[model samples]
Target chain A: MRESRSDRIFYMVNNIFLFIILIIVLYPMIYIVSCSFSNPRSVTSGAVWLWPVEPTLLGYKTIFENKDILTGYTNSAYYTICGTTLAVILTVLAAYPLSRKDYALRNPIMLIFTFTMFFGGGLIPTYLLMSNLGLINTRAVMIIPGALSVYNVIVTRTYFQSTIPIELLEASQIDGCSDFTFFRKVALPLSKAIIAVIALFYAVGYWNSYFSALIYLHDREKYPLQLFLREILIQNTIDAEALSKGQMSIEDMAARQSLFELLKYSLIIVASIPVLCIYPFIQKYFVKGVMIGSLKG
Target chain B: MPDNKTYFYIKKWIDKNWQLTLMVILPLSFIILFHYVPMYGIQIAFKNYRAVDGIWGSKWVGFDHFIKFFKSYQFIRVTRNTIMLSLYSLIAGFPVPIILAIALNCCKNIKFKKTVQLVTYAPHFISVVVLMGMVIQILSPKYGLLNNLIKALGGEEVLFMAEGRYFRSIYVWSGIWQNMGFSAIIYISALSSVDPTLHEAAIVDGASRLKRVFYIDIPCIVPTIVILLILNLGSIMNVGFEKVLLLQNPTNTEYSEVISTLIYKQGLASAMPQYSYSTAIGIFNSLVNFFLIVGVNTIARKLGETSLW
Candidate 1:
């Protein structure tokens, strides 16, 4: 088919519009990276725009040296790994049985699970309950209270129902396979993709979460990276507040302030490094997970 | 004889499916412990809750807490803030992904399209703390990127984060920037499922790409759009609480103190936590959210076939 002149104009306009959006999205990411690497003085002066100006590793070096930051990083890593594993297991435990057509109480059990999605006990009650259970100010508080998400359960169940055939179950049963054996050997192995997706979801949630920590944790030792980040980045406390009280000379204060500014840019990059590193490998799985979830919707 | 027969049948069924029951037992226990138990504890909202007295032992205060909350000055401020922010987000953030998806769909250059998708989606994975950190850095008055840009352009520097008026735009637009690509994935998938033969047919009939988008693409994805819109409306009461809390400062608290943040403050962050009063506020928020979702779902069912249930 021959293209018309107007169609050419439309294509040109559409491409330009999308290109502008692309820049809008990409510029901040590029600027932050550039600023993180640039000399603190250059960054504070806004000389580092699209590229690094007088590049140095001082920002990253400072972040790595900070004891609080290191402790928080370790805590976040622990929570994410432990929490994700438990979440995935619990989600599968709920989702798989509910997926089975012959499960006697599937519908009622599903209703019980889904009801939580609509309403909850809210903050105070939940907090009180947590305190009563002796989970407050503990590492278990982060992992246990939020182990199973009903949304992920539904998504996994939908995946199991569609992908794992009932015929396979019946055939295995005739071969004298028990339900537990079938689940262990067949259902789990067959549902690895959905499991990966669910695990990723939980891992990200655990890694990014701070509200749980804020409410439950009191000891600074238990603080996650995000909580530490809250102090440094958002609250602008710690060194800045401490420095003011010590009566630093003008030049020294200005120099420390510039380094603080540069530190934030580097902190953002370092904090995001784990997710960004794993993202490329799992991006396809994340897309697949969303697609599976949308099918139920 | 009938009772005995039913018992025998139940025993046989249990024997056959006990393994399945075993699989669900732990998770079921988790739900009951974590979810339903807190719900039962909600009764403390009507009681004068004390740590010594416990939830059940506390003396009942009837409607006192509710009444106090209803009469409080913070009530209107928080509710208004919550609604305005959510509505602003919905109005501004909703259509952006659809536009992005459609634009991407129309682009024939696969490499450019893939690059756009990749870069745009990257920000969504950044922790909320990090994202907010970036926002504060970019909007800082002295030596910040935006202020620097303003200075370079011969405009006076502005404290973007400090001012209450700039809060909503900054929050909503940043949210859009972070989420638009990730949210567009669903619509992009929906667009992919569009029958290419329809586009072919439209083109053969002298329909241009833009015309095909309006006449075919939009219509095909309307159901997806409607479903998502219904879902969005259902959660209108929930302004992104964490982000609001992060963005909030002394100057902006008047505009930024939504119900969730208020609940956090009243319950946990205060010098003397008002457990009962905070619980009352929470219950009120939950009820509003519940009704909004149910009401939206019902309206969707009545108006279209895309109701959540």
Candidate 2:
């Protein structure tokens, strides 16, 4: 294709605009990383910019030393594992039955699920119900309440409908395969991509979740990483009085203050690691999940 | 008597599919217990709810809580704040992705496009707590990077989260920054599906690149845009409670107190949590969303083929 004068000018302008957008998005994230790695004084005095100055591991060292951070990490990991497993199973089960062409109650049942998506009983009643069911403050509350997403169920149902041909099911049935046997032998094996996508979706949700733990969990030991990060990250800066009443002198207090600031940047990266690491592996499926999930819409 | 054949078909269907029905039992029970039960529990909003007396045993107070909330000053404040913030977000946040998608669609460099998409979408994975923490630190009036830049430029440092005036802008824009890339995926895909032959024909007809984008590309993704806009408007009442709660100080509570956060505060944060009042507020919030989604879908159905229902 020949590049006309206007086309050339437009291309240059668009590329530059794209570059600016990139910087606008990336600068803060890079700055945070640089600050987290920098010396405490560099962070506290606003010296760090896009790159680390006097790089050190002190912030991360402190995070590792903190018993609460460790506990939160473990708890969050446990939640993610159990929650993702349960969510995938529930989604698959609910979605498969609804996806079956032979299922007579599919439309009404689908409405029953989707209606809940639009109107929930709000948080209070859900909390009350959780407490009444003896789920509040327990480990199960984190996984159970969020286990079956109607959105994922719909997405999975759409996947099964699109991918698995009805003839294959009929052939399996002719060979004396029952519905349960066919599902186990045929559908589950063929549905790996959607399963992976849904699992990744649920895992990320569980890992990044703090609100559920905020309202549900009581013990500090059971608090997720984000909640712990919230305590040190938000409360530390907001509650300066708590810092001053500590047994530290002026010099120690200043050092402690920088450490507090540095810890937040470190904790942000720490809390984000699970999702960021898994994101690349699941990037292909993630986009597919979104595409299929938007099928109805 | 005339439905004997239908009964036989029902019997056959049940006999053939009992195992399938068995497969649904676990998740069906979960939904009934967790979702339907809570929908039933919504009745507690009308009761003088006491934990000792239970939801069933509580004395009926009718619309006392709803009326009290309506009469209170916070009724106006939270509702206005919720609407304003959501509208501000809708106006500011909704268009960028469309624009970004257009830009991505035109970009000659695949590498740059992928890089931008990856980095920008990365923030969508970030938790609200952490995002709020970053927002606070970056917008801190004293030592924040933005303030430092402002001082470097001989400008006054702005107390963003602290000032009620700055709260909505900060909330809306940060939300855009977090979500725009992920949301743009739908549009980008839509744009990718746009026929290249149309662009080639426009180019042959001596159309400039900018003109081609407007004439050929923008018109192509209108359905996707409209449907997404409706979806966005549907959840207008359901703003980010975690971010608002995290960002709210005593000074900025007026601007930051959304319906969800208010419900959380009333229902759980206080020493004596007002369960019924909070439940009423929750129901009210859901009702607002219900109406908004329905209203938008109705208008959308009239205007276009794309409606949620």
Top of the candidates by TM-score: 1
Segments in model 1 whose C-alpha atoms lie over 4 Å from true places:
A240-251, B1-4
lDDT of 2 by residue, A166-240 (tens): 999989989999888889999999988899989988998999888889998888878888888888877763345
Deviating ranges (above 4 Å) for candidate 2: A237-251, B1-7
DockQ values of all predictions? 0.73, 0.65
Show pairs that collide, candidate 1. none
Per-residue C-alpha lDDT of model 1 across residues A211-251, encoded as one tens digit per residue: 99998999999999999999999998765443333222436
lDDT of 1 by residue, B1-309 (tens): 469988999999998878988998899999999999999989999999999989999999999999998899998999999999999999999999999999999998899988888888888888999999999999889988999999999999998998999999999999999999999999998999899999888888899888998999999999899888987988888789989989999999989999999999999999999999999999999898899888888988899887778
TM-score for the A chain of candidate 2? 0.91
Chain B TM, per prediction:
0.96, 0.94
- Superposed on all Cα atoms, the candidates' RMSDs to the truth, in angstroms, are 2.4, 2.8
lDDT of all predictions: 0.90, 0.86
Determine which window of 10 residues in candidate 1 chain B has minimal summed lDDT.
Answer: B300-309
Residue-level lDDT for A28 in candidate 1? 93
